[model samples]
Target: MSVPQAKSPPKAFDADSAQRALRLARETLQIEANALIALDQRLADGDHSIVQAVQLLLNCHGRVVVSGIGKSGHIARKIAATLASTGTPALFVHPAEAAHGDLGMITAHDVFIAISNSGEASELMSIGPIIKRMGAKLIAMTGNADSSLGELADVHLNTRVDKEACPLNLAPTASTTAALAMGDALAVAVLDARGFREEDFARSHPGGALGRRLLTHVRDVMRSGADIPAVSADTSLSAALEEITKKGMAMTAIVDVDGRVLGVFTDGDLRRLIEHVQDFTKLSIADVMHANPRTIEPQRLAVDAVAMMEEFRINQLLVADADGILVGALHIHDLTRAKVI
Candidate 1:
């Protein structure tokens, strides 16, 4: 038997190789960025297709049906999700599966957004006729405007790119980026047309921090009832200090006989008093308190409370009812712990 040749050793990693690798990666990013710039210029040059597609989606009475194959399918799913979260009802359906049985998901009042780089995906092409036959509007996102799927579409969005970021120019790099950008553009336009607000977005994302900040009311996250730190305005300074320590709040509310808040005494005020007064025992809580303190209503949003605290540079806020009676209290730490900050 002939002797096998010795296998060569693996090349050692060095600074030169690392530099070349980094340069290539940077070049790839720059090329993709340039593609986006070109797409932006094209849009600024008055590409009416994007606007027309947004109008079609806005006019859709039923849900939006987004369909694609392969990498385009992944991008299509993302587009569908974004549209759904931003107030537009949308879902992704695989074109191949649509041909199998998912076509039933499409309705006459729905709008179809089909994505394919070449505008010639056989799976999408197969469902194109069915979508049209069902009286659904078809919007095609493709690089080739003259391709079959483009010809069948009511609106053709041009997502063409001069080159792929891939060195071999075989992968869907720049094309997919352009397609995703176009989808985002359409979603934002429709969102603006429908006047979708942040509160509307928060409703769909109720489990998120933003939702908590927008939806949670001051009454929901406040220390109320016995937890409120308060003392009689005539209470001695020593007794007011005991109330603050017992209630575990840095401040205490001074209330009158009818339980209406007269003033507030805080740690900062205590510090200032110590600096100015020689005998703390002789002072009444009312004498050292800050009158007309900033207060928040129980019905306001927690985020508004945070804004108030930030604007007034106070760490705690007194929650009062319409009658100016102290109902609850909260600190910055409470908002931070609740993820409202």
Candidate 2:
């Protein structure tokens, strides 16, 4: 058997060389920055076509159909997802599919967003007339305004870049980045124009942690009823500790005969009381408990409870209503377990 050739040794890292590499990266970033700034200037040139298109799109009764191919397709899909997630109803459709039967997805009241770096994607050309004939507005995003798609569009947003970040100066590097950024800007602009709120966004992402944090009310995760570790104000500290231990909570609530909450006695309070009085059996829970403990309403958000805990530097809290009645109890771990922390 022929002997295998020795593998090349790994290159050693030099701090000076690393600094030079970072400097080069910083320099390349300026090129993309300048491209975006130039795009801003072009938009500011007041051609008004893209702005008018956006205004019309915002008024659209149907979905926004975003179509593109290759690298542009990826950016268009992201833009579509962003718009739909925010407030606008939008979806991505491949131009190649439009040439088949997917063109039927477009409606007269919808808006079409087409992406083509060279503005001459042949696949998009066949679907352009179909969208127009359907009375749908066409918004073109391209690097060249003079290309066929740009010329035919009702509005053309220029994404012209000075040069590609690639060493060959031919790859879709800077141009694609610029197009994606412009797409985000448009999506956010429309989102803001439509008055999209956090609650609206949460609706789009209900299964996500953000939605859980926003949509979950205090009652959803609070321990309520008999699960609440509560004791009458006349109860002894030893009895409160028993309730706390039985409930597996570090604290117990001091309540009135009407079940209304009066105060709370925490492990911290027990520690302090232990330092002064060795006899917990003789101490009443009312004497050792902290009167007027911070409480939350059942309708309050678990996120708000976390903020309160952080602000108060406390780990446990009682849930009560306007009548000061003990309805539930919440611990910091509760929020953590709910992934609201």
Per-candidate RMSD, Å? 2.9, 3.6
* Candidate 1 TM-score over all chains jointly: 0.93
Off by over 4 Å in 2: 1-27
Residue range 140-194, candidate 2, lDDT tens digits: 9998899999998988888989898766888788898899888888888888888
True-vs-predicted CA distance for residue 21, candidate 1, Å:
1.7
The regions of model 1 sitting more than 4 angstroms off are 1-11
Q: Which residue pairs overlap in candidate 1's backbone?
A: none
Best-performing candidate as measured by TM-score: 1
* Alpha-carbon local distance difference test for all models: 0.92, 0.88
Residue 45 of model 1: what lDDT? 97
The C-alpha TM-scores of every prediction are 0.93, 0.91
Residue 133 deviation, candidate 2, in Å?
A: 0.3
Residue 61 error, candidate 1, Å: 0.6
Model 2 residue 219 CA deviation (Å) reads 1.0
